[model samples]
Target: MKAAAETMPTLRAKHVTPHAFRHATAVHLISAGVDVTVIRSWLGHVSLDTTNHYARANLETKRKALEKVTAPTTPGGQPSWKRNASVLAWLDTL
Candidate 1:
């Protein structure tokens, strides 16, 4: 084991720790669009807020997502669901 460690000295380089691996895994899951709740369960976190902190994205990613949202409208300036009143009323009953 000593010889192997010597061959890969950087593997035990300064400031590299197990927690870094865990943090990287969490960030990878978040980048892949995995749900926060699932990441919390995977990391055995008792509080969802802790998981949220781990998955906090940068401002640029948030801005890009917001830019992709298109408004709901039809070609003739009408609402997208003009004939969906009955469907909406049925959903409200639930």
Candidate 2:
């Protein structure tokens, strides 16, 4: 099995290890917007925290995601506290 894997041209990256492949898979899942819970199961991780470490999203990635979801503010726009206030009110009901 080892010989077959080694002979594959596609698997011929220099100094690649099993751990590197695992990390790559985790990162790809994150980039593809797969949930961490799904990744935990896929990677056989016993804890969600372990999956989180492996597929940790950097600050810039999160910022970009938020940017995509939120409307751009015009110059001198009023700060909108209503959104958070409504969320907090809803949480309080729960």
Candidate 3:
């Protein structure tokens, strides 16, 4: 990082930390479909729960997962869940 900063004065290394790099790497790997257990092992995390936190941080992944289970549209051209307040409320609990 320092070497790049020296050659490219525009490179800002001051704001970057090892933790930031680790977080970025975790997010990237999660987005790329790597298994959480592998990431946990690579990061030396003792628990899968800790690595899951990184997985949860990827909004794109969350969105993709949501898209997979999305309710199908009804004959009215809207998902039935959209008309059910209780269903919406239940979904919010997730």
TM-score of each: 0.54, 0.55, 0.56
Sorted on TM-score, highest at the top, how do the candidates line up?
Answer: 3, 2, 1
lDDT of 1 by residue, 1-94 (tens): 3564688887555465678889989987887789999999999999999999877786655886889999876776766465578877887899
List the candidate 2 regions with Cα displacement exceeding 4 Å.
1-13, 58-63, 66-77, 80-94
Query: Which parts of model 1 are misplaced by more than 4 Å?
Result: 1-14, 63-67, 70-94
The candidate scoring highest on TM-score is 3
lDDT of candidate 1?
0.80
Give the C-alpha lDDT of model 3. Answer: 0.87
Query: What is candidate 2's lDDT per residue for 1-94, written digit by digit as tens?
Result: 3565578856555567789889988888787889999999999999899999966776766886888896868555645554567877887899
Per-residue lDDT of 46 in model 2:
96
The TM-score that candidate 3 achieves is 0.56
C-alpha RMSD of each candidate structure in angstroms: 9.4, 9.5, 7.2
lDDT of 3 by residue, 4-61 (tens): 7988877764677899899999999999899999999999999999999888745787
Best by lDDT: 3
**C-alpha lDDT of all candidate models, in order:** 0.80, 0.79, 0.87
Between candidates 1 and 2, name the one with more favorable TM-score.
2
Clashing pairs in 2: none
